[model samples]
Structure formats: structure tokens, C-alpha cells
Target: MGRGRQKAKATKQARDIKYYSPNTDYSALQRELKGPEGRATSHFANDPVEPDYSAYVDKYADDLQEDDGEVDTRRIG
Candidate 1:
């Protein structure tokens, strides 16, 4: 109900949290970290399939090129 009581409770909680050490399961962790036993071939095992971008190539192609079909790579302030 008072500041002193609240401070004491908060300090006790902080000490308890600071000293707490949770037990870890190393064998289960090793299996999970090791990944699948067999791999067909993939850089990313869980990568989502990508959609085809060929349909938009014609629409946005002009944005990437200048009037003479060259990218204006010169820096401008």
C-alpha cells in the first residue's frame, strides 16, 4: 500500500529473476539444431516458393532504363 512496501516487493522480484537458472535439455537441442537427416538439395530448408515475375517485366522495364536504354548511375545531390 506504501512506497517502502512496493519497493521491497520489486527488489525481491528483481533478485529472484536475476538468480534464476533454467535447466536445458541438451540432447533435444542438438537434434533440433542438426536439422533433417537427409537433404535433397537446398540453401534454405524452409524457404517459401516464389511467384513468377515475368508478367510484370514489360510494365516496369522502362522504369529501370533511361531514354537511351542506359541506367543513370551518376550520383546527383
Candidate 2:
């Protein structure tokens, strides 16, 4: 309600946060980080699939080759 009360509440919250230390499950953390199979290979198991852009090159060959005279060679302010 008052400025002093609000300030005191904020200070108390800040102090609590500063000194806060909850129990950490290191085994669970290891499991999550290492991720199954007793190894970390689960993340690297699959290779990322790349999309083919070669089709677009053939379709827009003429458009890609044609350059408009509106090419700006000067530095833009």
C-alpha cells in the first residue's frame, strides 16, 4: 500500500531469491543431458534433411539471368 511497505516487500523477495537453493537431482540432470542409451548420441542420431533448390534455378533461369538496370552501385545513406 505505502512506498515503504512496497520497498520492504521487494527487498525481502530479492533477499529470498539471492539465498534460494532448492534440491537439485544430479542423476536426473545427467539423464536429461546425456539422454538415454548411457550415451549422448541420441541427439546426433539423425542427419538433417536439406531441401532441393535446384528446381527453382531451372524454373527461374531467364529471370535469374536478366538483370534490371536499376542496380545501385553507390552507398545508400
Candidate 3:
């Protein structure tokens, strides 16, 4: 190959790429859920068909309790 073409082939072979998994913190989510602005944000973020948990107490009464604020790792992938 010519000089310019040879360099292009060598550069392509020398290149390396790697991908990493993203890290997500669930604790921050709990803080957001308890925060004032979070309540309003949650309302706008949720589906209209779904009941709002922040305003309605009985909506998620079966799924949550006052003392049950712990994160469930079992549900995570």
C-alpha cells in the first residue's frame, strides 16, 4: 500500500474501545421521594391513569407502609 493508505490501516488496527456498565444509586431516589419538589415532580412524571401516591394515601397502601422505606435489592437486576 502507499504511505498514506498504510498509515490509515495501521491506525484502524491500533484503536481499542471498551464499554462499562452504568452505576445508579437507589438511596438518592428515597431522598427525592421525601423532598417537597419531588412530590410535585412525581405528580407530573406519573401516568394519568395511575394513581398519585404523594396525594392519595390509599392508592399504594398495599405496596408501602410508613416504616417500610427500605430499598428492595431483590427487585433489581
Best by TM-score: 1
Query: Per-residue lDDT for 1-77 in model 3, tens only?
Result: 47998888777766632344457788998877578652444446454586556866778687666557776569655
Evaluation by lDDT, superior candidate among 1 and 3: 1
Residue 34 in candidate 2, Cα distance off native in Å? 1.5
Q: What lDDT does candidate 1 reach at residue 60? A: 89
Instruction: Give Cα-based local distance difference scores for all models.
Output: 0.87, 0.83, 0.66
Which 10 successive residues of model 2 have the least lDDT summed?
A: 36-45
Over 4 Å off, model 2: 38-77
Better of 1 and 3 by TM-score: 1
Cα miss at 63, model 3 (Å)?
A: 54
Q: Model 2 over residues 1-77: C-alpha lDDT tens digits? A: 47999999999999999999999999999988765685645545477878999979888998767877678699989
Candidate 1 shows a clash count of 0
Between candidates 2 and 3, the one scoring higher on lDDT is 2
Return the lDDT, model 1, position 26: 98
Tens-digit lDDT track of model 1 for 1-77:
57999999999999999999999999999999887889657687587888999999899898667467666799999
